[model samples]
Target: MVTQDGATVTARSIDATRDWLERNLHSTSIIETERFGFFYGREQALREVSLGIPIDGVTAIMGPSGCGKSTLLRAFNRMNELYPNTRAEGTIRFLGQDLLKADPVAVRRHIGMVFQRPNPFPKSIFDNIAYGPRVHGIRHRAHLAELVEESLRRAALWDEVKDHLKKSALSLSGGQQQRLGIARALAVRPTVLLMDEPCSALDPKATDRIETTTRELAQELTVVIVTHNLQQAGRISDHVAVLLAGGVLAEFGSTRTVFASPFSEQVADYLSGRFG
Candidate 1:
């Protein structure tokens, strides 16, 4: 078992868990991109973009559509590989590992993701959370139960459905399903969680819950979220990166700094609703 004061890691953990990271890890960062670019066939989606994602914090990637927000987010786990003829250039480092060269499946396991919309399986709620751990060779029923319960609790959903573990996940409300997706990701005990517009499809109350859960999750996990809602970014992020036209990383800094004083006129204009 392992735990960090602010982070709720896991009931059991490996040597590389957050609580066991080197004392000086914060001096580096959770991940860094250097001259990163991406392409789908002949079309370029990102270009010469570079930034650092701090560990165990909420870093919001904010931009209008077609600004490469999702492109950069997917690059962290090599999800870009799903498309034929897709390729990347330059490097993305996760701690000491080269993300572009890392094993895709393993990378995804260590850095889980929650999509723009909820996507729970037709299986029971319990099964949705247990599936990932079980697939990774955790067959002990007692351990699976404990993991599912802890994950759901961390996602702020356990009490709502504790007595309905066997109910079909599809039967739950949209907000509940989204929380279930988060719980599913947490059940794998990842160190980082990537959210691609996680609350875009939810109502205001659901969006608030997701934002709240993300803030809490950041205590133990690095969270990178892509958002079109600048207000949401300001509310939940410690840092914000503004991607601009031509796939450029126009500005990046603390949310307070970036929102209060964007370095670029383009970013400032976008923030002020002048133009995207």
Candidate 2:
């Protein structure tokens, strides 16, 4: 039997499971989780999950609804702490220290997040992108302008909004707004970017734009995205981590490997549309 905290899979032998993890857990990992768990008041949201996020490339955390995908993503930057009566245990190492133990503000500066929906501040496009760097103490106009333009360009939003820098960010389309949100996060120059269903609210064309931007961004930054769309994950992610009901990490490996040869029947079923 293989057991992780309270989660168990009797069908998988402990030795086999260990072997599989050893093979997939890359040595160049930038973020490592060790028996991590999170709680909300009296309820447990994540239980004894452990995995490695590579230094560069996109990593998709996928599972069914209410499987703690977003919860885990939030935990990385200690955003979970914003909720009352919440707590986390175990280690989430980034830069060789437990991120859970680090200051939330400091952690957020290094690990930026984009939400499921476009939520730009009711400010101009320039202000939206410049917000983070300004808060971080870049007071010079030229510097802020440089950061804003660089961020927008990095998010693939510069060409579309460059001439309308003073316009309200809310004026953009759903996809443009989402990309604006991404640019805002990038302005802080985070080493890692966390995206939670970033394309869920957009149309196909917008989703395609976001997907393209994501692939390009992965070339320079480590991106950890939470998504339920299996095909999207397969198309963009370098690694895939499948979380089961109750936040159990059932399978994790390169996207190609996991999609091609799932580790267990449950994983196979989940990938095949037989079950979530």
Candidate 3:
């Protein structure tokens, strides 16, 4: 899932899914961050960092291990708040609403997250995708069916499982399960999609399919992804941010620029394989 082009590493881990997103995705700028930081217990996981996420494009967060990439991604939707003794400081605005101050429920409705692992529900695929709409008061059977179809279509999984809507989601392959997870997230109609290394577990062919799906989805939703694969970042991202120790944002710019000419020595070193 990782590739090297001379001095640069082209991360292919999430390339397939991201590529899919780029193709059918619409572009929008739905979130903005300003001087954000997060803490686990008394330890700081992220420091002052700021970035603008375009509404309809893929923005990738990349860095070496323990560089706060995941922590910063969680702040966009306040996912950090779920853990005990976790806190965030600074401003993260999702469509002008401050995430840190907003109700967690409301924030979740606007920003949805997909984890590294595929976690489909034990129930049927139809039920898994319908769960969100049902929770929000959508009860008509017709409405639920429509939502299910649309979500699955958007996730590029309709053709694969259309005939078996009643089958348990766990019956699918790892790649299919991950796409189901995405479809479930999409069922809520979130304005922002946050993915944490979504393709870390799939084979090359499956990964390719997911990348293409992500590119298409970007046409209608904003996406923020945290990935360690540098090649993957370059292939699917319109913008890229490089994180470093102490949660510092070493460099941030267009993917072309960040990969071609990193703004700092540290970023250059990391990308060049000198040191992280």
Best model per lDDT: 1
RMSD (Å) of each candidate, 1 decimal? 4.2, 9.9, 10.1
User: Candidate 2: lDDT over CA atoms?
Assistant: 0.85
**Candidate 3 local lDDT, 56-135, one digit each (tens):** 58999989989899888888777778899997788986655576777776677667888889999899999999987776
Model 1, residue 160: what's the lDDT? 99
Candidate 2 lDDT, tens digit per residue, 140-198? 88878988899999999999999999999999999999999999999877778999999
lDDT tens readout by residue for model 1, 214-251? 99988777899999998899899999999986688999
Best by TM-score: 1
Cα lDDT of all candidates, in order? 0.86, 0.85, 0.81
Candidate 2 RMSD to the real structure: 9.9
Which residue segments of model 2 deviate by more than 4 Å?
1-26
Clashes of each: 0, 0, 44
| Two-way TM-score contest, 2 vs 3, winner | 2
Error of 1 at 151 (Å): 0.4
Query: Clashing residue pairs, candidate 1?
Result: none
